[model samples]
Target: MIETSEQGDVAVLTMSRGPVNALDLELLTAFPGALSDVAGAAAVVLTGAGRCFSAGVDLKRIVDGGPSYVAEFLPALSTAMLALFDHPRPVVAAVNGHALAGGCVLAAACDVRVMSGGTIGVTELAAGVPFPTVPMEIMRHAAGSAVDRLVLTAEKLPREEAYRIGLVDELTDDLVPAALARANALAAAPAEVYALAKQQLRAPAHERIAARRERDDPGVAELWSASATQERLRGFLSRLAAR
Candidate 1:
């Protein structure tokens, strides 16, 4: 699910699930471990194989597996996301293509996001699911004023618009090189100091997540498992297939 390679001092982790690299339970469960595998690198560059960074949660899996699967999946999703968010080393997102819903949240959790050609946004509402506390907090921290439109409208903004809205730190066609350069630049700082400063900057969001996750996550999972939500997701899948 993840392919790890070394590019000089930077660890490059590529999501290789293929097609759109949708986040399923297996992929989510493997992600944190992949991060652990690269702990020795000075920095990390995360991207996806083929044309997509990720297309977000495997809603088809959710619709097919029902509530039991949802109960198991949500926790894994949170774990993977938090692992990236709290990684001690700098992490850069090399968003090569579509990053929607959970995929957008994953990119948002990174230290710097460099994009080439991609559309990015959160479309959880359109899927008839509410954001889990972790994703909500990350989006709040990254998107600022753009969060409302992203969450509520569920529009996938093109690369230029995404850059304008501050969703991506840099826009360049030389994705991996630009992302590697930025990651290296950030890694130049004292590792311990950089990690500590990052933790401090993200402390507010972390605190909010710690405070509300226990209460909020279960409700979010329950909603995702609700029959109406499943039906909506099925409809969404159909629409996607039609397209």
Candidate 2:
């Protein structure tokens, strides 16, 4: 599900689950281990194969597997996201294409996000699910004032608009190169200092996650498993199929 390569001191981690790189339980479970495997690298660049960074959770899997699956999936989702969010080394998101919902949250977890040509937003609400604590906190930290609009409206903003709203740090046709350069620049800093600063800056979000996750995540999972939410998910999938 993850393809790892080296670019000098920077480790390049690509999400390679084909088609849309949808976040299934396996993919989510594998992600943190991939991050751990790249620990020797000074920095990391996370991108996706094909035209999508990721399209978010696999709704078909959810609909087919029902509550049992959702119960397992929610924790994996939070763990994977938190792994990326809490990685001590500098991590840059090379958003090669569409990053929606969990995918957008994955990108937001990075220290910097560089996009070439794709929409990026949190569309969890549109998918008939509420944001789990990890993603919600990450988005709130990365997106600043735009979080409310992105979360509540569930609009996938185009690259330029995403930049304007602070979701994207840079927009470039040369996505990997730009992202690598940024990662390299960040890696040049004293590792401990950079890590400490990053931790300090992100401390509030982490605190929020710590305080709220235990209380919030179970409720979120229950909602996802609720019949009404499943029905809405089915309707959302039908709409996608029609398109």
Candidate 3:
């Protein structure tokens, strides 16, 4: 589900899957534990094992479970997302490819985000999915005024455009090394102070997201499972498959 490489006090997390990392239930279950295990790490760098960061949530799983199942799973998912926001250490997202939907949320939740030259956006509109209210709130808090294109449009912004929109901290051909270097620099700070500072930076957003997650998650999950979104998603994927 996740591969962790420990180098001193830094934990490098790689999501292993296909050409694109797909967030199935296994990945979701494994994610919280991975973050927990790296609690004491000076910094955390998150990346994909293959050509992409993550494709998003596994729709097949949702389809198989039927629409009603989303509600049961959402609370855990919300917690998992919030955990990254409230992470003790700085979490850097090293984006290797298009991050759509949940993938974008994952990146947004990180303390900093760096994208490879090949990266793109997997906007929810393009995915034929509505932005879950809770996730949108998380994005607003975590990404600040940046990354609005990801919310309003379904368009996939290439690395350059992502940089222009401030969705990425840096656009580099060598994302892994850049992300690692940044992590190391952050690690140089006093560990206690760095952790506390990072916490303070995100505390307000975290609290707001936590409250909304508890209050709005059920309805958001139900909206995600709505027939309209499902049909649109199915059509979009089918077209891709046909292509």
lDDT accuracy of residue 28 in candidate 2: 99
Stretches of candidate 3 above 4 Å error? none
Who is ahead in TM-score, 2 or 3? 2
Off by over 4 Å in 1: none
- Considering lDDT, which of the candidate structures 2 and 3 is the better prediction for this target? 2
Q: What TM-score goes with each of the models?
A: 0.98, 0.99, 0.89
lDDT per residue as tens, model 2, 1-243: 899999999999999887999999999999899999998899999999999999999999999999999989999998999899889999999999999999999999999999998799889988889988999999999998888999999999999999987789999999989999999999999989998999998999989998999998889989999999999999999999999
In lDDT terms, which candidate is top? 2
Question: Which order, best to worst by TM-score?
Answer: 2, 1, 3
Candidate 3 lDDT score at position 171: 77
* Candidate 3: tens digits of C-alpha lDDT, residues 1-243: 689998667799999966677776667777889999988788999988877788787776666666756665565566677777778777899998878778878888887888984555646777666655556776786556764756776666777877777777887788878898888887787878887997787667667766775567666677778888777778777877898
- Least lDDT summed over 10 consecutive residues: which range in candidate 3? 68-77
Assess candidate 2 and give its TM-score to the true structure: 0.99
Model 1, 1-243: lDDT tens per residue? 999999999999999886999999999999899999999899999999998999999999999899999998999998999999999999999999999999999999999899998799998988788999989999999999999999999999998999898989999989999999999999999999999999899999989998999988888988999999998999989999999
Model 1: lDDT of residue 125? 88
